[model samples]
Target: MSKSNDAISQLTEKLPILLIEDDITIRRFVEINLKRSGFQVMAADSGETGLSLMENRRPALVVLDVMLPGIDGYQVCSQIRDRFPEVAVLMLTALSQDLDKVMGFEFGADDYLVKPFNPLELVARIRAILRRFNKDSGSLLCSGSFRCDLRAQQLFMDEREIELTPQEFRLIKVFLEHRGQALSRDDLLNLAWGEDFVGDPKTVDVHVRRLREKIGNAPSTGRIETVWGSGYRWREGS
Candidate 1:
């Protein structure tokens, strides 16, 4: 590998992984496996505790369990997405149904694994997500009055910071990268959510709508135009 790739790989391994599992057995088991895989682990037994730790020591990725006390994984995942858009979320759900997986994604989970999964597979998934997210760290994308700081995972409109969820941040980044190009829902899902995402194609529409709302319809912020047959376009020179 090249020097840059080696640096990113080292960086990916250095960021801590937060594990939020209410079950003691599972938490300890997963924590051990994560440490064995060369990752630093921070284990929380409750969603509230996990959220609290997030504030104190933000991890690069979170391994969240579906069933938890006082918030549940979905709610915690939503909070993480809203509060720490840079942190990737990997949900562990006992439910293997498609609906359950899709629900996790809607709540901003980067990926989901059914319960009784192999420890190696879990570690692999976590590694994959970290590597993908770490690809462009500290880069900035600017257009007109908008400035996107990938380093801080922040967006600024006319120098005013605008809040965005994790999904919205990814979507906006893709749109900014492909400004003026009509990108289909599938195109967006693949680009923003990755090819492994197992959710409805229309999920792209929901996220795009939210992103548009955050960026606003003001001409200064540019516009997300909906084509008749195509999906949407981040219209440039608007």
Candidate 2:
């Protein structure tokens, strides 16, 4: 097996991948492929069932479909972000429009894939997303008044913990790592969302804005300064 597949297999052994798709055929196809890929799989037919599974199973990642019967994928993704900010969500949909992809990201999906996608590609994407979360597991990333415990996956400002969605946490982690440097949208996207991410650069702006709101304008939050015509920078020092 490839190194990527090896990583996915190891990660999924402990935490199953939750599959939420209303279409029985697609659901089973994905479930079989995932199991073949050496992943632990839990299948759900509806968003409600998926969320319920999330409560108990606490899967490492959710493979969610957008066209569920009740409480569409966006709502499910939003709820996942609100309740389980640590879990990664990958939205599967037939809608191939850019707007739909952006909507998924806005609703807190870690990635989006349209229907008719290759099961192999789906596995690769899952590996990529989970890999991003698992990277940098040993050490703390500290800058200004922010301190991030990499192993614990927690961020604190002024020694107080701050709640963050997975995306937000990744963004801040990138910012703290590259303080005082003007990181362009592409740079931030590649660092935080991974180069495999398919979405708008505006998504970076939205996340940065939200992170700013959560961290506030306090000098300790390490002022996120916008470089005109460029991107953003984390001010050096507290």
Give each prediction's root-mean-square deviation over alpha carbons: 2.9, 2.2
Cα-based lDDT at residue 170, candidate 1: 79
Give the whole-model CA lDDT for all candidates, comma-separated. 0.83, 0.86
lDDT of 1 by residue, 1-238 (tens): 7998678667877899999999999999999998987889999999999999999998999999999988899999989987887788999999977778778877877778898999988987787677667655679988878888988878898899988765577788898899989999889988987775655676776676667767887776687889778899887644
Q: Which regions of candidate 2 deviate over 4 angstroms?
A: 1-9, 12-14
RMSD of 2: 2.2
Task: List the candidates' TM-scores in order.
Answer: 0.82, 0.90
lDDT of 1: 0.83
TM-score of 2: 0.90
Task: Give the winner by lDDT.
Answer: 2
- The TM-score that candidate 1 achieves is 0.82
Q: Give lDDT tens digits, candidate 2, residues 31-125.
A: 99998888889999999999998888799899999999989999999999889999999899899887888788778887888889999899888
Deviation of model 1 at 159, angstroms: 1.5
Report the C-alpha displacement of residue 47, candidate 2, in angstroms.
0.9
The 10-residue segment of model 1 with minimum total lDDT is 196-205
